[model samples]
Target: RLIQRAKRFWPAFVVAGLANALFGLLDAGFVMLLEPLVSKGLVGRDPETLARAPVFVIVIVALRGVAAFVSGYTMAWIGQKVVAEFRCQVFSKLLRLPAEFFDRESSGNLLAKITYNADKIARTSSSALTILLRESAFLISGLIYMLYTNWRLTLFFFISFPAIAAVVRVATRRFKKASHNMQDAMGTMTALGSESLQGYQTIRIFGAEAQAEENFKKTVERFRRKFMSMIATQNLSTPLIQLLAATGLALVLYVSLSELQSGRLTEGEFIAMVSLMMASLRPLKQLSSVNSQLSEGLVAAQSLFDILDEPEERDSGTVDLPTLSGEVVMENVTYCYGENSPALIDVSFSVKPGQLVAIVGPSGAGKSTLLNLLMRFYHPTKGRILLDGHDLESLTLSCIRRNMSLVSQTVTLFNDTIRNNVCFGLKEVPSDEKIIEVLKQAHAWHFVKELPGQLDAMVGEGGSNLSGGQRQRLAIARALLHNTPILLLDEATSALDTESERHIQAALDALMTDRTTFVVAHRLSTIQHADMILVLEGGRLVEQGTHQSLLAKGGVYSRLYRLQFGEPQLGTTTS
Candidate 1:
């Protein structure tokens, strides 16, 4: 996948590498010229050659400098594009993932893949690989020149090969292991930091600031330790490589001295061979350390690819539904998250096209799960759900959702103007007059009109600048504008005062007049007027009836109602 993506930039990548290679070739080629220059220009004092020596030196340096500049600049540009493309892939994959994936993975860890892990690929593509390619080329070219100068002497250069390989093998393993640990710690740190920042107000109110700080410090410490481990491996390998190179040089020196005494090697030739040997050793040292960067990048790439490889939410249904009639039915529908116990069990019910159904339950009784199922966020583990007599799975997911509107307890608003937030996800936005009419219908236009920019007012991050009631009203305005046949209201009125709630409820009642509305009610009083109330307890539908009938039956619904309203006992003493 990486190769396929990078193929578009193949010309630039190759040019960058060729620039580096030219520098390496020139570097080795210069050492080869040292012998002839010293022998003819200096020793024999050849006039023309001596006079042009300065020009030759300048030209060689200039070419190498130009090559280095082009290689560095071009590689950097390619690195930016690579990072950008990978981040885009990660983000696009996220949009297609199933709700279950979000249930298991935190937003922070996912963001780390884009912000932290993707950068390692950039460093690998530009810098780490740069050293790997350039240094290898330099080492190969230098070795070739030495062999040409004195084949017998160059053979001794291999005396330390086995030792050098051993050091590199050990260091590579250490680097890879340490880098993996560091990345894991980095992800944890990012998750913890995001969690802390988002809930800082709650943490402070509960006097848990010290606890939060300690937890953050621990993650940061773990990240530091892992980073140090990678650094230690890199630091330790350098001296070991230098010592091996020196051993090889000592053996080569001994062979060279013998060859010189036997009159087989000239002084100029001997000097050139030693110069190439030193030049070769520097690149060899750089090559050894470059593995650390490569190992780190390898670990990051694997993490990113793991996300890319995950199958998107199953959309096997070929049905492309048009507008729905809002009729809904569930026949023994059950849902379980992974291997856990079912959150909804054998839940069977049916609602008319324009009926208001209230789902009342304790905190974990799967009240929200019903809405989640209707929204096709998850499919039933068993049984089936039907919309307008068509299987839920048969209808396209987007088409099924288009017929519904949701306003949850926590209203979601982007950092955009009021107009955009109200008309979000609509391919073609409604006109300003239409938006204003909807806002008034939601009882939100009063305050919206008072804002400086009115319709163009920025909501700030997650609508933080607005009060909870104002945010909820805006959400209602959005739902009102959508005019979906099915409306799901999950405690949307909780943030408002009694007067505001009454007004919003009146507007909502008008809106739900001919719509299939499901209210996941927290307050029994609010849903008392629902046509049918489904009372749930421990993931089972224990009772179903209207408020007056359920209260008369004296079941779970009656018990919950008496508890909330503190209904006076028929015959009992006060505390």
Candidate 2:
């Protein structure tokens, strides 16, 4: 996959590889020049050759510098582009993944993939590639030069090469294992840090600072140990390889010196051979370290590829409804989450084009799950939902959601101006007058006007700067502005005070005059006037009737209503 992504940047990598090879070739030329300069200038006392030698060295150095610049710059550019593309692909995939995927994964791990793993891939593509290409080229070139000078000594030097290769082979496996561990540890640390930061207030309020600190320290310690293990393997391989190379160099020197004394090899040739042999050592050492870098990058790439390969939310529907009449029907629907037990079972209901339907249930009664199915965040495991007489599965997900607006208890507001949050994703940006009108209708205009910047005032992350009621009102205002034919209110007024709830409810009443509305609330008072009431318990619709009729029946709804609002029986009589 990495290679597939890199195809577009192949030209840059090819240019970099050629330039790096030129750098290696220049090293061989420098080594060859060193012999004549030393012999002719120092021993034979040739002044003209010595003077020209400096100019020759200067030209080689200048060309090598140019080659180095091109290699470095081009590789870095390719690395950055690769990192950017990987990040974009990962983020886009995250957005398209099924809701179940998020339910089973952590946001922090996803974030680490984007920030940490992507960077590791960049380093591998850039610096690692540079070293692998340049050093391997330099090593091969140096070997050729040494062979030209004297093949016998070059053969002796290569005797230790197999030992170095064995060391690298053994360490490569350890490096990959340690690198994978370290990446997982990094994700754990990021998750811990994210939780601590987001819940700082909870930590302080509960006086669990010590516990939070200990947990974080433990996470960091694990990460540190894994990181050290990776470093240990990488560092150990280099010196061991270098030691073997040094032993080979010593053996080669022992043989070469005897050849020199016997007059079989010229002093210039012997010196040149030694220079080229030594030149190979630096590249050899770099190549040893490059293995670990490449391993780390491969591990990161594998982690990211796993996410990218996950199947996206199934969207096979080809029908697009430009508008919906707001009528909704569910026919014997059943749904489950993963291998867990069913969430909704054989449930059935219907809503007229503009009727208000209230779904009241206790916690864990599938209220939110039902809303999720309606929004097509998840498909029903069995049966089907129909919108305006068309099967929801046959309609495009966007088309299904386009006619609906949702206001839940937990309102999502980005850290941006109130105007932008209210008008978010509107086909045409609404006029200031239109924005204020919706705010007024939702009873949010009063507080918004009191702010220093009015509609332009910035809301902190998740609208933290706003009070609960204020945030709820802003959410209601947003839904109002959407002006869709369907409205989903999941405890929308749960955050508001009685007075605020009354005002917002009035606004909602006017807004629902021509739109289908679904209200999921545990607060019975708010939905008492709903056009139809569906009572649920343990994933079953236990009761369905008007508020007054259910109260008269004295069934599950009556008992629940009595529990919340009916008069308490006297205990004194029994005493």
Candidate 3:
């Protein structure tokens, strides 16, 4: 991981190293100028080229300054490129991930991994790589100059280096652990915010605003504490390194002064060595700081790699059904949401082309689960679902869903113009007239045309700006515009009032004319004319027939019908 990350900025690292080395060499050369300035030149005794010595040093310094400027900008550009590539890769991975992966992971937390964590990895990796390369190069060049000037004094400085390494190692391990905790807390905070925002209406309706705020505050506080702790752990390394540097400098200065006094070291040589020692400040500081930054980067890289490494969606051996007749069949399917609680068991049914089928049952009777399986949102645990004459598992998901349209209970609208929402499922740009035609057919045109901007008004997020019935009607209009052969309606009319339901049901009746339709309906009256009315109880198909045929038999469907529309004391089922 480290090597690959470094390679991402290889060009920058290489350029920074060369530039830093040139600066270090010039630093040593400038110190050599100090010798002449103090001795022969400082006395103002020469009238020759010695008068121009300071000008030569100034030119060298300017060149070194320009090199440093180029190095910094080059590294910054590399960092931005690396982050951009990482974000794009994560987005591509999201498209390839299986649908079940989204069910198990929160969208907000996954978004953080793609955006937040990728940036952290890029910033830390690039900064650390830049620091490591430039400083290591400067430190090496500075040390070579020091040794050539006086190897004995340089050797004295190395004695305290082991202590520096030991302190940095301990600090970095804590930093990495704390950083991981901080990132986990961030994901939790994001999840809380996302869930709350999505369900803001429910929170307000229940008057649990305070409770939701308190819950969000708790997550924010936990994340704050974790982040502060990580920052403290990283900060500890700086002071520890400073202590090591102070101790090392004291020893080196004492030994060098004694050498100078004994005539073993020239005055010019002693000053040069001291200058080189001062140059160690940035490199030595960076040597300690790099470990902590690199640890944080590794923590982020581990998170990013964890996401990228997940198993992607497979299209193996899957072929298109050419064209579907919209005959759906579920054969003895068993499905469980968890290991212990079954959602559906041994459920079987079939719907022929252009038939209208209504699946009615009590809540939690696998009504939605059956639709979910047909949509391939979750694969069944046992048996198979067939589209046309081919098994659903044998066809590509895109191929199967292309022939189907779904208008669900919970309507979703993008913050876009009404025309786009109505034609969302089309692979190509749809004609404006076609969208308006469907809107008229769905009985949505009356309100839409009255709006200030017909078909062009922006629907707020999830259509929150529209009334419930209006949103439902728009959803129906969208389905009608798609014009697929199959339609799945899951409580699509539950939000509508009696008058609105009557108006929209007529439109739905027209839309379902020659389409194979499956309706998960709670109001039995709406589905009385279905070609097949299946009564589901406890995940089993209890009764199956047209409404009139089931009423004649006087079974579960008859009991439910009487319970819904009959007098309480009539005992209609027993009669």
Q: Give per-residue lDDT, candidate 3, residue 5.
A: 48
Model 2, position 359, has a per-residue lDDT of 93
Model 1 sits at a Cα RMSD from the real structure of 1.6
List ranges where model 2 is wrong by over 4 Å: 569-575
Which ten residues in a row are the worst by lDDT in model 1? 566-575
lDDT of 2 at 426: 86
Which candidate number has the best lDDT? Answer: 2
User: Per-prediction RMSD in angstroms?
Assistant: 1.6, 2.0, 3.1
Tens digits of per-residue lDDT for model 2, 1-575: 89899999989989999999998888788888877877787778899988899899889999999999999999999999999989998999999999999999899988998999999999999999999988878788778777877889999999998989899999999989999999999998998899899999999999999999999999999999999998999888988988899888989899988888988788888888887777777888899889999999999999999999999998889899898989999999999999899988888998889999999878888999999999999999999999999999899978977899999999999999999999986889899999999999999999999887999999899999999889989999999999999999999999998998889899999999979999999889988998889988888888888899988887878877877885443332332
**Largest TM-score belongs to which candidate?**
1
TM-score of each: 0.97, 0.96, 0.90
User: lDDT per residue, candidate 1, 1-575, as tens digits?
Assistant: 56676779989989998999988888887887888777787777788878887888899999999999999998888888988989998899999999999999988888898889999989988898778778877888888777877888888987898988999999999999999999999999999999999999999999999999999999999999999999999988987888888888888888889898998888778888888887777887788778898899888988999999999988877787779889999999999999999999999999999999999989999999999999998999999999999999999888888899999999999999999999998999989999999999888999999998999999999999899999999999999999999999999898999999999999999999989999998899899999999998888888998999998888888888887888864456777
lDDT of 3 by residue, 140-182 (tens): 7778877887889888877778988888778877888887988
- Candidate 2's TM-score reads 0.96
| Number of the candidate with higher lDDT, 1 or 3 | 1
How much lDDT does each candidate structure score? 0.90, 0.90, 0.81
| Candidate scoring better on TM-score of 1 and 3 | 1
Please give the lDDT score for candidate 2: 0.90
